[model samples]
Target chain A: MKPSDIFPTIRPWVEGLVDVWPAYIIKPQFASWQVLHILSLVVLGGVSILINLRLIGVGVTNESPSEVQRNLRPWMHVGVIGIIVSGVLIGMANAERLYDSVAFTVKMLALVAGVILTYGASLPTARADGRVSAGVRVWFLVGLAVFGLALFVFAGGELVNPGVWHMILAAALIVLIAAQGAAPVDLSGGPAGAGRGPVRGHPFHRQAGRLRAARPGKHRLCLGVPGVDLRPGGLAAVHRARSGERQAGQGHRLRHHPRLGRGRRRRAMDRLRLTHEEGPRGVGPSTTPGRGVRSVGRPGRGR
Target chain B: MLRDFLVWLQTELGKGPGEYPMSWSEALLGSLNFWGLLEGTHLLALMLFAGTIFVVDLRLLGVTFRRTPVSVLSQKVLPLTVFGFAIVIITGLALFYAKPLVYYHNIWFRAKLVFIAIALLNILLFHGRVQRNIAAWDTLAKPPTAARISAVASLSAWIIVITLGRFIAYDWYECGKPIPAWANVLQECAASEHGAASLAEVAQ
Candidate 1:
């Protein structure tokens, strides 16, 4: 069924509610709903990224993926409930207008699909394996596709006028394309395969050390521990080494690192864009201090 | 004397970016096709930057993701966060260049900048004072009160900043046009002689 079609059944009821309590949404105090909506988004997006990062084993290495998920799960529920309440209030305030708005309809569909994928699929898999299952990855891409479609329609709402069926067709096409595109990429391994069963030798650690050892002059450390100065060159060198190791180890390491999903390499490129100024820098641990851990931030000679 | 200096600065800057050769570039970017693309990237970057920061702050609050040491999480997520922030900076500047004077006179725009400054200051205070001894609570499931307070402050600052940034579009405060008297104190644009220039001339 078309998105517009599904909403119509309840649109009359919602419109009636709006008519009775016009000031509920129109009054100045209703602005808080907007604030709450945005704040809910902060929580939702925050926890979503946290869990996703955990899945990739990038953040919270000390905690198992399950522990991370369990800790954040309650907050995610609160965020979801807040979003629902705020979202309902917003829709009720301008029911008729929103009912007719293509952007609104698309946003609702995306939010539903996103919720399902997030709570139903992605989180569950992350809870189990500390990594997103391949199936969840596909749905995740579809959810992103729908979300992007909503954004597109919302941004260009005035420019394009499409019927409900047309929007649904477009959304379907987007999901189909995104699923096809994401199918080939292996997201199961996590970022640089960091989440794969922990091998005795931390591959990234060794690569980081080797790269640091190879190019020691460009870096100046405040302490004797590794810090987050992983220049593009260093990461590129590490990327190459990781690729070779993946081939040799075969299935032990991920072929592609889900740095932050698709377009990660572009994001990486942005980080590396400043490489010309800080050439041949050694990749190291972040600068935040942790007692008893070897930080290795002290200045050392370059190879 | 201070008022004069401020007026002169506003008048000069409020002359709009169109006065410079960069205006041509701005015109190109402001085109319907390009503007949409820039906006899309800007939004995406915002999500990444905001999302990453939110997770980091949550860790500081000891709210969740406690298994990982704070230092390690900071190191791992920061590069990507910086990358997202870099995109936002680039796109934000381009957008500003498109309508410098208009944005300059906007109260919401000014508020956004203020919020950003406050957020940065909060970051500084946290890193300079509290973070120096982060190692002690690096693995604590519930960080100390100071860290939690810092986290709360950071989150609040960013929320206000984001809200203000969004409002910049809705509340356009154009130079060469009348604005609220209160806004005049902040912008001094409405009364400036330079404010008399039409938006077209500003685009020129």
Candidate 2:
């Protein structure tokens, strides 16, 4: 007997695992994780859309490019996770059919490229602070474009081929939803980037942070954590600041707290992004409370 | 009655060219070709459609890039839409000619054309008067009821147009034979001789 013939015998349980539910029908097995997976897709999909658009030449006309990247950076994790969850769900639902689909293979490849590009491009350099470089944007765009093209081909082929229109339509709906969720980016005002300044003085950078913080999901909480700052010096500053805020209460900005920057950093020197910047160069978490919001007052205030 | 009418239409339009008011030129240039051109035009139109629809939907749903004035997006994309749709209509007519008497006699096709006309007329009648109200909805979390209705209608009509057009091929129900009437003669001559005898055929 051929090895193939014996394979099923070897893997005894593999043959009848999937019951005869028409593979085309997206079965509604309501696991807690499935709903969470869908929900994750929504959250991460939206964040991915917003960031990808900013990477492209789409929305947020007035904000500096770097600011757009910073605010949108962390949220991309949600989008990647969403894509993974939704992708796996859909793939499992149509495993037999998708296994042979050229579009599926291409999309998988594109997604892999996208993930790699996102990692490679979104790394924060000391010079750029949290803003992903244009080179990063290029890779990000390639990733997005490849992914988008994969989706378009995958979905479009199904329009004329064996795949059901309903599946294609549903997928398209998800795409549009994700697209709508993404924030826009534009180069109309100037080059889509940020410059080096104290994070205090950089409203563009701050605005990016605020946008992530304002997101109505776990992204806000995830990003709101002190150690998640984009700059190397960000985590320590956030840690100290959070401590001050908790100790001092809501109305008291960090300006009231004094001399704790030196004392705290020496203790927590091996910590987060804020470790270096929290030093007493007079712009410590204590000295600078709201000193850096002026540029954020530029034309697109809602940004 | 509607089903019967549709069945009757299918019976009538299945007849060939000599028995119908359709010609080669009419098929190629006059109607079918015209609408096929719309397929090309639709690419541009689809973008504008997406653009306008995006703004309106976002306004209704309350989303971002909201800072760009709603009126501006409407004005920008609406003109492109109109221009694109003109191509669609012109092309649609060409497509209709590709099998005219059959298409003319097909109830579904007739209904589709009627829907197109209705969609067009609706835009003409209400779009201008309603543009301001629609624009105001852009920044609102919940657009005013009237604007929402208009948005819904606008979206609905476009969706219907697309769906019906697709179904035109799928749910095609042609009528039986047609008499070679004067219009049919014009089309015939146009088919055989490409406008050479169309004037005389029309005069006859």
Best-performing candidate as measured by TM-score: 1
lDDT of 1 by residue, A1-303 (tens): 223455557756766767566436453445557767767776776677666655533444445567667877887887789888888877677677766666566567668777877876668876785445777777777877776766665545563333333446546543332221121121235457763221112224344455557877522221122122233344223533332223334332223555455465556445343332233222333333431211112111111
Cα error, residue B27 of model 2, in Å, equals 8.6
On the 0 to 100 scale, the lDDT of residue B151 in model 2 is: 60
Cand. 2: chain B TM-score: 0.57
Candidate 2, CAPRI quality class derived from DockQ: incorrect
**lDDT for model 2:** 0.44
After TM-score superposition, the amount by which residue A88's alpha carbon in candidate 2 deviates from its true location, in angstroms, is: 12
So what's the TM-score on candidate 2? 0.37
Q: Candidate 1 at B100: error in angstroms?
A: 1.2
